[model samples]
Target: MTTEKLFPVNGVELCAETFGDPGDPAVLLIHGGTASMLWWDAAFCAKLAGYGRYVIRYDQRDTGRSTTYPVGEPPYAMSDLATDAVGLLDALGVERAHVVAQSMSGGIGLIIGVDHAPRVASLTFVSTSPGGDDLPPPAGGLPHISTPDWGDPTAVEEYVVRSIEAESAGVFDEEAARALVRADMARAANYEAVMTNHYSMNFDEPKGGSFGELTMPVLVVHGDQDPYFPPAHAEALQDAVPDGRLVLIKGAGHGIPEPLWDEFLAALAEHTESS
Candidate 1:
């Protein structure tokens, strides 16, 4: 069974869930921007736990049941988010954990891997890139990421579905996407804050140290068909890190598709166990 709790970390209450035995190696799963822990679906966590890993997924501030701020006025920066991830491990009494991060949270993982190196056992970055001017640009611009109406859940859900369609390279599942969006909408303290606050975060400074500085076991997972941060980004990231390995998921885009979970899980298990 999954155990859910609210942890007070970095001066905020973060809703977190854990699976499997605590004594097992811990894997911290960080979702993308404007996403809650729900993005790392429960079934997926259970499957990872089945591999004898202590899996952890949490709702970051301004997402799901965590803390919220006034819309269009966030008081924190990307560095704060990175700090929160480390603080969470402190609260959980986990000395070190294998960090599995998706999309925007990959930067957070990079920060932890570099700045708070002692707290991370390994890093598995998914659907993200190491920021560099020379890397190839995305296939196209991201969809205009604005939720039209917070009061209308249907409208918000439709926007999410459309956004996924724009970003995904695999087949789109309209029914599943709407269901997930509705649950997020129903559980959020402020849905508008969840969707818009991330954009307003202060990113004035760079995130983490250089990719070459990461000393831990590093795995780069990317979709060959990713529109945002194409496959080349993954190659560049892998090449930058010493002894880094890359797993290119065929037919996947910016997100991990349900049909490809096993492939991801297998790679993740081997990486964490070896680390």
Candidate 2:
């Protein structure tokens, strides 16, 4: 993978990994809540590259190798995160690219696609819901195993290890699971700003105007058994966007990097190509 260094809107330095030729069509991938760019698995990235597209994945601010916020006030907002995405593209001299996002990052990508239309060739939302007063939070609260204090390294590491072991028992390959767990641990060590950003985005009421402004093709992918954002949430988002399609993956849950990787990549490729 090729690496590029970027400075975002808030002056946070970030690292982005690139696959495929630079001249190929580009797809920018935004990962879900508490996840770094490494959440996008190597297999999926390779598949996209094999499709002859330039795939770019970055650690959002406060995650992975990106710069983190100091101990003072948090600069966390959906708008700020969305702006960082655009700024990354600008820094890379990319005029336009298809945007693919999962979980909380879906909202960020939507904001960018609607507000900065020219910069987005298409929008793909995976395992996410559009934010609004009517939207429901995750049912039964989040899984105990999934919840971790963003500021606590020990808790985060323990959470990662437990989550991976629990979720990947007989499903995910052992090596892949271990790598993902390690990546999650690394991300959690620097997660204060990203978690703050997530909370800020969650509590803020959706204006409801930005989504309708999206003219590019939109694709929503959700697992049939997703515990976090249920399938209904994906349906709601599909109804909200003018041009949206929903694809449901059976026997899959909230996470997309493992069992649903192939389906996710296929849907992404189809959407990007059609758009």
Candidate 3:
């Protein structure tokens, strides 16, 4: 896998990494809130690469080795995030790509599908809520988040790992969890910048027109036991997109399970190839 590097886009730089040959089909992976692209396991990316897919996973503006501004709230809107994705594709000279994202990134994917339809091939949403008021609110709602000391970067990092461990519970692999935490924390630019982006951005509204307009294949994968967004959220997404389908994993939570990685990868491969 290629290491993370800064790509200039929209007057800022986004940190991104790549795998597989450039000649293959493209799959762009977007991570969740406060999470770097590291959340998408390297082994999973390698699996896609082996399948003749050119996979690209990248950090959002504030979360990883990308641009960060600690002094104030983020000036960019959710649309800007969507623009960043398309911009990244442009930077790579990719005309179109399959967008695969998790959690908040899923909402962003929907935006891209709606506003920049020509640039997207297909969409895969994992453990995420649907955009817009057409569907009922997500089941179980969003889980309550505990704030850590924003001034102390170490505390912020610890909180991130601890929170993931708590939510993951039974399905989590200790070694893998630690490795991801190390990758994310080591590369995080600033906790204040993360907080700024998190609080300032609007996640509920569908700023990129209607998801119904996306005629391409859409896939929603969610865990039956997801604390943040329940299975019904996946159902909502499926309902919203005419060509969308849902996959409800058993015994999994908000995070993907290590043992079930094969199942997740298999489904993703099938969906990608179908598009």
Candidate 4:
């Protein structure tokens, strides 16, 4: 995309970035829980653009530079989040686009595929499960990290520590990752607390039946080292979604690390093309 802007949709303004030419086929990239579009990373977006795609990534509400619900619960359901994505496309004058949603955001993509199929060309889920709010937890409980208050000097360090624990082999650049998280935190309000709510928020049962009903192509990407939603979750989704395929990244975790970025990028490009 040639420009980045704050586009209003669904009663709020979303901070969106575009790469490559608009006339090219569009691919909307939705980041994971509590993450801004920055998680998609500049290099990653450029690579997708090199594939001749108009890649659009945005900061979802309550994260990044987008609208925030600083107090209490957000006044929306999981499906409403999906509606926001469709509304964004409508605002941007995009008739249809492929969707690559990661983690909890993928739940929104699933809803869009079911409820707003005409707006989506294909669906790709990364590190997520179709089970939505009710997926089983891993054997080990989530690590207990003391998240510092938002904007505290120690906040960046906290972010890095948690990330190091999540990435399979700690292959990422520590200083760069810290800087990114720090910037994202400043753009957000009450970042850590807000994310806690986002992750734990309950959802009503999904309206559609199993994912097998979706007619469009689907792809499931999971990291073998992902401790959050394991490889089995990806396999299950692949089996459930009709005409779906799965790819497992050998050294990746729930988060995309530098080492697996190339493989992930290539696989995603191929998946979108075939779809």
Candidate 5:
């Protein structure tokens, strides 16, 4: 694997990791809210690379090793976040690639597919909901991952560790879990511009109408037990996209990359390869 430093939109520097041959078809993996690229397990990325894909995973702004908030400007909108993805691809000289995203990142991916259609070859949405008034909020008081407060170092560290543990309780490998928390802490220590991005930018419109303009293939993967975005949301995505297909993973939850690693990899490989 190789790591590349890229400057996407808004002059934000993004830390991107790549696997497989650069000459192969590319698959961009966009993580969920408050999640770093670490959310996409290394084993899963390797598996996708094994399927002859050039897999790329990057930290969105304010999440990992990426640029954060500006000094005076307000938080960025979801459209800006989507534009960031496009800018990253442009910076990396990637004309078009497959996109796989989860949760909030899924909404961003939908925007990319709609607004930047030529740049997206295929889309794989995992454990994501169509945002808007129709989509219900998460049951608990889960902080929106996109707008974290990195002001208090100690508190941020503790929050990162606890959040990772709580979310990946029984699913993640113990060492992997520890490493993820540590990575988050390290990133938070250096970056404190978390709250500069708007969480409600895309919440205004349902993800339905956007898909009407997307011509690329789409695959919706959701866990039957997904707490945040239940199976119904996946069904809604399927209903919206004329060519989209939904796959329900048994006994899996919102964290697909953790519990449903193999299944997720298989689905992605099959979907990205087929016509």
Candidate 6:
């Protein structure tokens, strides 16, 4: 069973759900921009819990049931988001956690690893780049392009389906995506904030440390067919870290494809256990 609660962190309320025993090692699942904890499915969390990990997934500010700002007016910077993660750990009384982050959150993971190294046991970056001018840009342009009518839930669902279809190359369940999106729209405090605020947030670069300074075990997992950040980005990320490894999901895309869940979970279990 999973327990849901609201936490006061970084002067904002963040809705977080936890699976498995608190006595076990903790895994913090951080979603990408414009996403909530729903992106990290309950079943997936359960599987990680089954691996003897206490898994925590939360809604970032401006997403899900967490705090929100007016459309296009996010009061915090990207670095603030990273600090939020650390604040959440402090609130939870967890001194250290294995951080698994996807897409934009991967950058957040890097910041946390560099700035708050003592709070993290390991780092898992999925479907995101380490950000350098030399890295190859996302294939076929950037993602999250199709805008839908915010008032129309059906339009929003269809838009999500279309976005997934474009971003993925492996097995995708359209109905499942729709069901999740439906819940997301229904539960969101402000659906417009979910769609627009993240894109406009100021991104203050991390201070004092670089990726090469990360001493913890870092795992870079990327879909071979990921359009947003290609395989080369994963390679570059892996190469940047002193102790890093890469896992390429075959025929996968920017998101974690259901068909590759087993492989992803196994990699995660091993990485966290060894770390």
Which candidate should be chosen as best, given lDDT against the real structure? 6
**Positional deviation of residue 17's Cα in model 5 after best superposition, in angstroms:** 1.6
Arranged by TM-score with the best first, the candidates are 6, 1, 4, 3, 2, 5
Give candidate 5 misplaced runs (Cα > 4 Å). Answer: 8-10, 70-74, 132-155, 165-175, 189-192, 195-209
Top candidate on TM-score is: 6
Q: lDDT tens string, model 6, 202-259?
A: 8776685778999899999999999878899999999999978999989889978777
Tens-digit lDDT track of model 4 for 1-275: 33568988999989899998888888999987778888888888998999988899998877877788744577777777788899999988899989999988878888888888888889999988866455556637556666566556586557555765655444557676777777776677667544665665556434875487687889888888777777777888898899898989887888677767888888888877732
lDDT assessment of candidate 4: 0.78
Per-residue lDDT of model 3, residues 18-137, tens digit only: 999888889999878777777887888898888889999988878878887663667777778889999999999898999987887776888888888888889988888764565444
Cα-lDDT of candidate 5: 0.72
What does the lDDT come to for candidate 2? Answer: 0.74
| Comparison by TM-score, 1 against 5, better one | 1
lDDT of each: 0.87, 0.74, 0.78, 0.78, 0.72, 0.88
**lDDT (10s digit) by residue, model 5, range 1-275:** 33656565556678788889877888999988767777776778888899999888888867777766553343666767777888878877788989887887787888888878888889988888765568665547554543345666656655555565445424546666667767665664244444234353334332445766778999999877666766788888888776888989887767664656778788889887732
Task: Indicate the worst ten consecutive residues by lDDT in candidate 2.
Answer: 199-208
Residue-pair clashes, model 1: 0
How would you encode candidate 1's per-residue C-alpha lDDT over 114-220 as one tens digit per residue? Answer: 88888889999999988789988878666676657778877888888888887888557878878888888877988889998988897643245577889899999
Q: Which residue runs of candidate 2 sit more than 4 Å off their true CA positions?
A: 1-10, 132-143, 146-155, 164-175, 184-197, 200-208
Error of 4 at 254 (Å): 0.5
Backbone collisions counted per model:
0, 0, 0, 3, 2, 0
Q: Is candidate 1 or candidate 6 better by TM-score?
A: 6
Error of 6 at 105 (Å): 1.0
